[model samples]
Target: MNFLYEKITFIFDPLHHFWEHEKLSRKISIMLVLFFVLSLLAIEAKRLGILTGPLFSFVPTNHFYAISAAFTVVLILEVISLVFTLPCSFSRSVGKQFEILSLILLRNAFKELSKFPEPLTFHGNQEAVLRILSDGFGALLVFGLLGCYYLVQTKAAEKAMRPTDLYAFVAAKKGIALTLLGIFIYMGLHSLTATLAGREHTDFLHQFYTVLILTDILLVLISQCFQPSFYAVFRNSGFALSTLIIRIALAAPPYYNVLLGLAAAIFAILLTLTSSRLFGKK
Candidate 1:
């Protein structure tokens, strides 16, 4: 167990250290933005023959592509934020995941827009129109639901614990965060290598959520050590359900994905509100 603990810490130390520095975090954010902008410019230039071939040729030249890229970066940052926030508040961390999923749906909607027929008419391309309508409206609905979640979440009070128990809980959560960071790094490298090798990449979102479900179950077990109330367990378990919904969404068609994902968020919010009223009333 000691060796395993040290290995986990070693894998996650950089992420742990990165969040400790506000300046470093800001610098990294700026660098990601700059990289995205430069990449878009490079891709556009290559498409126009101002740059050489074999660079981002797999990517198409479209404004939607830029939007997708930017959102992809945001999704990665949000996942990191979720890991950091989990140690502090599990509900809030789950909310961050909902936010990430909403952005992903929005990103896919933009991609659908890019496929719109030239001259853009409702005639003869009804399928594309329906896709855009479904994705766009679905994203809007999810975003609205997310706002409701925030309001409900604000009403949920934090559970008090003995200082020693709180310390142990936080430490355990941090260890889980480190493990997630390791998974993120490994998935990224796996995706990059697969892309370079001209092979189909793994569904990273699915994999991440699978790990997350197990992590949340572990967290629930750990919370038992602190003599958590019934509501605490229910809320944590609800979060696991939310993560499972997201994993399922990844394999679903766009329209169904949006509906299922939105339902999951709503369910989670309802659970939180119920827990607050029944057990967290002050």
Candidate 2:
């Protein structure tokens, strides 16, 4: 177990460093801008009969689709960031999940925009407009609630019986985080292959959220091995439940998706507040 843990750490550290590098982030930002502009140009070209292929079939010829594509890429980056957060404290990881949830809601709002005509008239797009409002405001509400959640968060780490125990706990979480990163890359490649093959690809983020639900449970169990206090268990388990609710929110329809997301956020905030007040050391 110790050897495996060391190997996982050895591999994860450099990958994590590369991901967090300033140069890579700048390049990714530049690539995203280029992708957005190229998407718009591609769509216009297809519309004007300048581009033709089966690959272009799925690409909608709408200015708003470019925006949606850009948002989707941004959301993908956020999810990757969330994966890295798993090695942190459970509370911090949960906070990262909430951040991704808000971005997903915002992406949904922009996705609805793709349904509108190029000129973007409001006349026939009432339902789409309503969806946009629902998802947009839902994101804002979660964003605001996330602030409150963080405000109530205590910065102190949970105590272990020994320093070595704390070190082992972190090592275990790093292993789990590395495993999740592998699964993430596999799922991403699988989804991309399906899309390219003209197969019906699943919603990549939604599928990953299902995996994340199981991962949260695993995290709770692993955490118990090091910190078995009632308060610690309850807090971590409650956060797992919050993640489950977020998974459901992702699967829900538009208006109700927003509602469920808000419910999940409120539940998390309440859980944090209650746990802190009741469990804090005097």
Candidate 3:
């Protein structure tokens, strides 16, 4: 019975500890590969104007639809994640904390996504902003749970792990938190900016966008005192950068664009450093 109990804990430990034993370069490289492939599809869709929905493929339409579809897809994935994660989270032998916790997490997330301010006004947007926020809310909750899981995993490790490996567990939990937080900010910002611009945003929209993003990034960098994981999380993914590129390629602006690009680059680099360090790479 004791042996069975220990084995169950190992499954969770291994997931968190894998980050420590696994090499940094390899993990990032793999993540990047997945990033690149997904990015390529996104870029290609934009280039070919296929992102606006295949049924509307023949007609040249708008960007809002594309954003909506993408955001919807992301939300669906989180919902699916909840289905798998709930059992792992709350269903305790007697108490079932994971299952209960998971339900609360999912509910809060959905509420954020679907529920907007009262006197709900669509500033000419179809529904993308609300969709993104609702799904985003759930994702954040799940991420919070992930942090909890990591911490629990750490305690589990203490039971069977070397004394020295304890710090490794802490590091991994912190790393995951920082990394996920950054992603949350980046995507949330992206959705907000685009929503503000709407479909009929005039010329110099990118310039305004560049300023907003740069300011946000700079603020985060300064606030965090340049923490590596903090920087790495927000700054890690180049998707937002890609979105900016697509806009610029559509003739947004290049000179001022570079200024904004600099901010994004700094954000990605710093956050990656933070995450890598937290993963025990430091």
* Distance from true location, Cα of 129 in model 3, Å: 2.1
Give the Cα lDDT of each candidate: 0.75, 0.86, 0.37
Give the per-residue lDDT digits (tens) of candidate 3, residues 1-282.
Answer: 345434544554554455335495367557555654565466556657566754433322332333333433344333223222211211111012222223433333343333343345567434645444543454454345434434443333111334433334333333333343345456556665655455443323223334434433433343233233533334323323423432342242322333333333333333333443554332
Clashing pairs in 2: none
lDDT of 1 by residue, 60-114 (tens): 5664566667777777777777777777677777778788787777777766756
**Candidate 1, which segments miss by more than 4 Å at Cα?**
1-17, 20-29, 49-57, 61-63, 114-125
- Decreasing TM-score order of the candidates: 2, 1, 3
- Deviation in angstroms for 266 in model 3? 38
Q: What stretches of model 3 exceed 4 Å from their correct place? A: 1-20, 28-34, 45-126, 142-282
CA lDDT of 190 in candidate 2?
94
RMSD of each: 3.5, 1.5, 18.8
Ranking by lDDT: 2, 1, 3
What shift in Å separates residue 200 of candidate 3 from its native position after superposition?
A: 34
Q: Model 2, range 1-282, lDDT digits (tens) per residue? A: 778767877887898899999999999999999999999998889889887788767766787889888988898898899888888888899889999999999999999887888687999999999999999999999999999888888643354468777667777888888888889889999988887778897788889999999999999998888878888888899999998999999999988888888888889888877776766662
**TM-score per candidate, in order?**
0.82, 0.95, 0.23
Number of the candidate with higher lDDT, 1 or 2: 2
Instruction: Select the stronger candidate by lDDT from 1 and 3.
Output: 1
